[model samples]
Target: MGTTQLESVPEPKYWHLKTVLSEALDSEFSVGEILPNERELAARFGVARATLRQALEQLELEGRLQRRRGVGTTVAPPRMGVAVGTEQRVWPGVGEDAWQAVGCTLAAPPAAVAAALETPREQSVHIVRRSRVSHGQPVAAELLYVPQTSAPELSAIDASSEAARARVVLRELHRLELQGQDSAVELGSARADDARQLDRLPGAPVLVVTTRYFAEGRTAALSVATYRADTCRLTFGASGVEILHGQERQAS
Candidate 1:
């Protein structure tokens, strides 16, 4: 007599596909290696295009992969630590790190930014927007303010010239005797603009890092940086490195 056998159900398509693709990225793929187009991957997996895209979106959000407009999805490297305050408050480029100034603008600050800047609601501040990209993937976006004093020398600079503008800001900031700094990290969602710059949808989860640079006992400069939380683990002070390995969240 032939025995009837119970068939095992295939894993839920999205979860199974994401799991398979994630493991593949960790194993076969090296950081920055571009993957086959999503269409091709979907075909290979025998799943609908939506299902494939869902999985890809998850990977990108988790920083396991990155997707660009003209370019395709590529494996993402680890997030940069960027040494918050190791020895002393050094000026930019003092170390091997490089910070590229994306663009600069003058506008009314957000409520939080205004509060941090200790400026009036009607007062306009020069909001310099900067982005840090490492290993070909965008990592952090920073908003810096000169407060008219931190960069008093900037008036001598030709703002139209990118290098001139960047130099003016850096030159003035470096003049500060490198005093102390205070930083705070809190749960945040990418605002409309941040999400756009970070290449994610509105309301995407992010770690907002606000740091205040003090020199001569006064607030010298202030920076509000947003880091992709899914792909980043924000560390603070001397204890952060030890805390990074505390515990990994278990999959529900």
Candidate 2:
């Protein structure tokens, strides 16, 4: 790294340093390369250690750097592309292999989800938990809400375990004639549960994709998937496959 003293600018010093560090990452660093320690970097940039720390945090938030446990800060790989929506609309878990069923339970969903599902706020629904992994790293977590009215045939004898219940809920969803689906994406902070599933800190940046499945002329199910922002990039397209970090690959 060069000892390029930054000139005074209107932006905060840490912000300016973050921009410079980002450029250095692009030109001088490779993915997974550990950056110099705080003392060395602060001296190199002629900035206070506090300023350097702030800049590093910013870079990490922007998905440019990663601070591994017991390993120093390193350049993060390009975000893996996660297919949020494709032309062929299918129910969650139908023809999908990327996500694994975690568990399922009956509970009252959040108010927003209840509103979206057009269910009574006090009504309990089947909440299915799922996780998605890429490159052997957890990348996303999901909660699929199914109203009782939507899966009237689910029985306790058929779904003996939590995972089994999740599968049965999905099976019931598949029985519905999937009329159409719509999705919306936005930046969000990871909640405690999602952070644990994705192996990220609470309040870490995340991309939230909310999808609504329409069937029988009503909102039958709702899916809210939270993806790790630092490791996943979302894509929407006609082809079922989505681009990987920097290359085209089949969605898994």
Candidate 3:
């Protein structure tokens, strides 16, 4: 690659540089390849280091690059197509689900979750924590809330550990006939717990997916999943699209 001076344009210099860098990424770089240092990049583009930094930050926000602690900046993988909705009728933790149950606890949910669950504010519910990984990287962390009313049988189970409690809660909850599910997606900043689970810095951009599972004419369970916005593109509808790091495939 040769040094090329950027021409002045009406738009911000960093924004224009971002465009040029994006093109170069496609034509000259491979995924996971570390980019040159900021000084080198600035000198090559004939832009100030400050402008180059701005452009790099924009690229990282757009999921085109990753800034690792020790690895520096590298080309990021393509956005993974995460299926948020499907026609198949099934409960979570059932039948080849991508999430892994990490732990479970009994705690009063947040006010919004309590309202959604239609439980008293002080009532403790079963909170099942789960995490999803793709390409060996954590992509999402979830909190599955099951009201005691939703999984009454759990009371009888002698769950000795957190994982055991999670299993029993899931088992009892699955006994309910799954009627349907609905989900809503919105932008969010990673909270401390979610940030740790997702391996992102505090306040990093995230996509919050809130889902309600229905059974017996009531909201049986609620799930709040936090996905790394840079790594995920939420997909809806029955026809699923599976996007891997560097490839795309269709799933039905």
> Of the candidates shown, which would achieve the greatest TM-score relative to the real structure?
2
Give one digit per residue, the lDDT tens place, for model 3 in 31-142: 9999999988988889999999899878877889877666788998788878777888778898778888888988899999999999999999999998898878999999
| Cα displacement (Å) at residue 213, model 3 | 0.8
Q: Runs in model 3 with CA error above 4 Å?
A: 1-7, 39-53, 153-157, 239-245
TM-score of each: 0.62, 0.88, 0.85
- Candidate 1 residue-wise lDDT, 1-252, digit = tens: 111111232755676677778888877888878898867787677778898788877776676776655677778767545434444565553454445677665557777766776767666666666776755656678887656556665554567766457656766778778687777888788898888888766666678878887776667767888887655766544422211222443121
| Deviation (Å) of 179 in candidate 3 | 2.1
In model 3, the clashing pairs are none
For candidate 3, give the lDDT of residue 96. Answer: 79
* Order of models, best lDDT first: 3, 2, 1
lDDT-superior candidate, 2 or 3: 3
Q: Give the runs in model 1 whose Cα sits over 4 Å from its true position.
A: 1-17, 26-54, 77-81, 85-87, 91-97, 101-104, 129-140, 149-160, 176-179, 185-208, 216-218, 226-252
For all candidates, the clash counts are 0, 1, 0
Q: Give the alpha carbon lDDT tens digit for every residue of 155-251 in model 2.
A: 3426678888899889888898999989999999989898878877777788999889999999999989898888787887675634376676754
lDDT of 3: 0.85
**Range of the 10 consecutive residues with the lowest summed lDDT in candidate 1:** 1-10
Superposed on all Cα atoms, the candidates' RMSDs to the truth, in angstroms, are 7.6, 2.6, 2.7
